[model samples]
Target: MEGMTDAPESQKRALRAELRERRRIRTASEREREGTALTQHLIDLTSDLGARSIAAYLSLPEEPGTRDFVEWACENGIRVLIPVSRADGLLDWAPYDGSDEDEDLLGMPTPTSELLGPIAINSVDLIVVPAASVDRTGMRLGWGRGYFDKTLGSMENCPPVYAVIFDDELVDSVPSERHDQRVDGVVTPSGIVAF
Candidate 1:
């Protein structure tokens, strides 16, 4: 993990807003192409890592798309687990069966399948997460929520944790704190960056 952040929370928030706005203005065709490239990269990562079961998330409309990858994993007999946000500032893991889903308390997409304990993620071979931005050193700036931070921080022998973002979101630096967890690498439309 990276050291204590050189940037403050306010700085982080401002950057997140700018990034989100940039994503919001992308043309539909652009997003589709990026999502396709992103799906291939994710599939390559899983294949390279030889993962049998993985933890991943459903992408939001403006985020780098993981939906296609998640669905593909389900169809390929890969045991996929998705996150369910809990009121306690932690996450619950649920088996992703390619079933209709529900949004969590935070309005993020979540599975309605049978829920597992938080540590259920421990068994997965890999964990793919969402991020607003990630720095060159692997420090991730999540979207204002500590959910991924807490989940990753609490892991015992956590697998290779990778964040999904657009290629440009890979920047020189991002505002991070002591609580922020650095990822093993990141997957983007252009390719994967293993930090």
Candidate 2:
């Protein structure tokens, strides 16, 4: 039983290491191709869901595919909330209206205009998370940061969690610890996978 328990953990660590190496070699063209595919998949996933309020990440330069989803969400009548960094490594969310130019916020690109309204995480109907990698079971490896995990932990009746990743980045498994938060779904270039 002890060995059985350790096996998964060992596998997770190895997987994480492998993914990190792969990401290091990923080219811009690859990211752009995958981003285009993933954006289309996301559009298909939420097009008819009737979601009123959504929480989504503002993509960085390395993750350039997020703008499409943001534009789609705004056009579809979903109120979009994006995370703003606070002093305590905590995130406070504000609405994203999609018209503002990009500004640097907490090392990530965010909207420059004050077009957001404050809201709690639990109030969101859906959440789209950024991931370094994801697996079939919906586990995600973030950028070695626990911000999303801690934020999700504080919510009750939280909406479904979806990890957004490029198609090639989706693997069969990933490294996860006890503090890791598992997603309910994964959005890839191919499709939305529900776990």
Structure candidate 1, residue pairs in collision: none
- Model 2 per-residue lDDT tens digits across residues 78-181: 88888776657677776788876554446665656454433466787888888878878777777755788888776778888888876777788776778778
Write down the TM-score of every candidate: 0.96, 0.80
**Lowest summed lDDT over 10 consecutive residues: which window, candidate 2?**
110-119
lDDT of 1 by residue, 1-195 (tens): 133343477799899899999999999999999999999999999999999999999998989999999999999999999999999999999999899899999898988889998999999999999999999999999988899999999987999999999988999988777899999999999999999
Q: Assess the local accuracy of residue 136 in candidate 1 as a C-alpha lDDT between 0 and 100.
A: 92
Q: At residue 187, what lDDT does model 2 achieve? A: 83
Worst window of 10 by summed lDDT in candidate 1: 1-10
lDDT of 2 at 178: 80
Candidate 1 residue spans exceeding 4 A from truth: 1-7
